[model samples]
Target: MIGLPAAGDGVVHAVFVALGIAAGIAVFAWEVRRRGLHDDRLWIIAGTCLAFGAIGSRVGTWWQQVDPSANDTLAQWWMDGNRSVLAGLVGAWIGVHVGKLITRYSPSTGDLFAPAVALAIGIGRIGCLLTELPGHPTGGDWGIILTPEHAAALGGPAGVGLHPTYLYEALFQIAAFAVLWRMRDRMRRPGELFVAYVAAYALFRFLVEFARANSTRNRNRA
Candidate 1:
């Protein structure tokens, strides 16, 4: 879900993304209540994360070009730039601290967000699976084969079985969510859970990239 949407898939992608956000918010609220966090300022922090995350997702890829002149204008970037989950995560982390500063709220929020984020990403990736390029050709018996039109739209090979990379990521995230949910209270430190989850995902993503059909990866292979 970190790339451009396929032609006419934008609305569908947005809907799933909205659903993911709703799910994340619901989980966050539930965690807050469960933890007996009475402070209303937590909502402000959550809102800040959402706002900054959205902005970061849109703007993160704008600087891919080294020359400023080669980059899109800010407005153009917002409308057409590639989005990235990692950027959104970084933005959310920054938002947490900014929100804390504004409201003078203290205490780590990572535990509450860890499972919620995992679940949200797991759901959000379904949209990507449906709408984006699946991945490179698998050269094996099993994978999704795109119709000619879908292949053309998504920049994939028609009739070729391709790795469902997004689905792989989605499954990983869902499993991580389950694991994080079970370990939610086991961690003694405040931010350790979040750090561990993010680090694990980063490693997973790096490994998964080799199976992806990204232009950069293709170029590297060449």
Candidate 2:
């Protein structure tokens, strides 16, 4: 058992999430400056993504439960710490299009946002690794082992070596960031790099789900 400290988990998660957002914005700004494109309209797209991403994160897992009654109320869901990154990405994708439509900025912003998104996910996942359910048992010597209290709180088993799925995701994101950074200037199209990154991540996440505690197999076993 890794014995993660459960105290102030929510606060720590929030802090890290904020840091991720700030880091993403900083990276975006740096990219914009490096490109030397002076279109103030890009900010509007960024703002729109932020607004929509927030909404998506809140509502993404709203229907995850088979029984509607088992789900959180809208108000509770909004106030709670729970979120869905996949849904948030979908929302941001929508936001980018809507922002471009509204601003009439025809250029592809995907390449600019790609690395930033990867870096943000890399940092944000640390919060999840610290506070959320680790994952299914590794059946091996290596893995996180939570305290009984923490395990109960996170809804996982105690005294078992659970897969550190979140850490795996964090590492994946970091690797994605590196790959994106290196390929940024080599893509034939402006948005091809972003598309490639998203596609790769989608596949990676699907495979990683097998080790995640929230997977259908794990839930059934639970």
Candidate 3:
């Protein structure tokens, strides 16, 4: 695995996250405007979703690391913790619904958000590709091969090819965005497109986890 020059000090993740949020919001706003559904309350909903999503991602990461044998302190966990994009999505969904209820807005904004979310996720996963562990061993030469030192740094098998899981996910999200964008206007229901996107993503993520080393940790321990 070769380190990205721009990922110095691990700030690439934060930079990409901010960019993702900005790009998502920009696309969402454009979609809302194009669909003639512009409303100030949507911004509020977006803000709420962002806040909750951040919290949920943190909590999800903490949940994954929860172990009685670990001697890490709360401050350490707070300062340096893992996160889950799936959990963030769940949190954002909840936030949007709660925001809708609070604002008494009834129209389904899912169609307006589907493409934006997909695109943002696609872009964000690039950061993951650059900064995070690649994935499980490939046992073949047809994948990202890491040097012994790099493999050790990422806790992967030394001098082996591994699945570029984040790249796979990024490509999937981009493809999903293209598909959803094309079908956005054809969907009869306002939220059906979003539902389809979420379902597809969930299925994809579940399948990809099988190829992820971290996903097998519990089984390995057992």
Candidate 4:
């Protein structure tokens, strides 16, 4: 995050993001195809929402962590992993509604994605854990042991076991999936389940931060 020329901010991570966008689109596309959404517009609308949502989520995460004067340069602050998933969730909502205004898609599309987005969150948390990135790392009883590669990637001196924050997030996301699944059909509104999921995930993250190593995150990664 610290060494990129404007390219990092520009399109340096383009491929990775495109892959993520494609994956998200593919998820929505699978839904559309499975449900027989013959309206090509549905694909367009879903694509637009997922695309903008991904950008907004990552950018929002970056924006939340950026504080000028905290670092000599903006990039320094913005590159930290301390971005806001909450903001990204909001972005996803906005992207869907805005795409609806532009494409006339219905809220049902958002409903279609309710469980999906949660699954993605749960999946992405695994990426975070595999790298052995820093976290609270308390009680050795239930944490992870990293290989030399993970340690090197995370700047650990090697032979150290981290708190396994990625695993924590993954487990919590699984719980979130269960709760949302149970509530999806019983809720009064199409989006209520999603709101509950967001709130629940936020609480989960807040609680888990206590086990993370980044004291600043433990203090304030929300």
Give all candidates' CA lDDT scores.
Answer: 0.80, 0.82, 0.74, 0.56
Give one digit per residue, the lDDT tens place, for model 1 in 1-222.
Answer: 123335337667788788889999999999999999999999999988888888877776678688999888999877766778888888888888888889998989999999999999888888777677778888985787877777666666777788888889999999999999999999989988898899999999999988877432111110
TM-score of every model versus the real structure: 0.92, 0.90, 0.86, 0.66
CA deviation > 4 Å runs, candidate 2:
64-72, 215-222
Model 2 over residues 123-165: C-alpha lDDT tens digits?
Answer: 9888878777878999986799877776666667778899988
Better structure of 1 and 2 per TM-score: 1
Model 4 stretches astray by more than 4 angstroms: 1-39, 63-84, 106-108, 132-134, 146-152, 156-160, 214-222
In model 1, what lDDT does residue 171 have?
98
Q: How are the candidates ranked when ordered by TM-score, highest leading?
A: 1, 2, 3, 4
- The per-candidate count of clashes, in order, stands at 0, 2, 1, 6
lDDT winner between 1 and 4, please give it.
Answer: 1
Q: Which segments of model 1 are wrong by more than 4 Å? A: 1-8, 215-222
Query: How much is 166 displaced in model 3, in angstroms?
Result: 0.4
lDDT, candidate 1, equals 0.80
Cα lDDT of model 3 overall?
0.74
Taking every candidate in turn, the Cα RMSD to the unseen true structure, in Å, is: 4.3, 3.5, 4.0, 6.9
